[model samples]
Target: MPLMHQLWLLVPWAVFALAAGVKFWRLTRPFRRQLAEPSTEQVRASLERRWRADQRELTE
Candidate 1:
């Protein structure tokens, strides 16, 4: 194949790869934000609160 034809064929693949990468980044954005904050105590407290609520419901 000629060099020009090869370059044209690669352009579509490059665009597809870039689009997939962007989609993946968007999907994981929420997880990335949460990891950036490092709020372990708050998460533990929230889980504890939910557990207490569930226990109360079960007892009642």
Candidate 2:
């Protein structure tokens, strides 16, 4: 009922909102980048390069 109690209750919701926003941004980033690119071939090449870089990083 007090202002402090109300603010305390909102802490969890605020944390959840921030986490969800970050997750949504990360999930959409690849699709958004692909859409902005001019050609499918370019997109494919870029994704392949990224995959290779990930593989190399893992091997190291």
How many backbone clashes can be found in candidate 1?
0
Which segments of model 2 are wrong by more than 4 Å?
A: 37-60
Which 10 consecutive residues of model 2 have the lowest summed lDDT?
34-43
Best by TM-score: 1
Would you estimate the TM-scores of all the predictions? Answer: 0.60, 0.58
Q: Write the per-residue lDDT of candidate 1 for residues 1-60, one digit (tens) a residue.
A: 999998999899999999999999999999998788558898899999999999999999
| Full-model lDDT, candidate 1 | 0.94
Query: Residue pairs in steric clash, candidate 2?
Result: none
The global C-alpha lDDT for each of the candidates, from Candidate 1 onward, is 0.94, 0.94
Candidate 2 Cα RMSD after full superposition onto the native fold (Å): 10.5
The regions of model 1 sitting more than 4 angstroms off are: 39-60
C-alpha positional error of residue 45 in candidate 2 after TM-score superposition, expressed in Å: 14
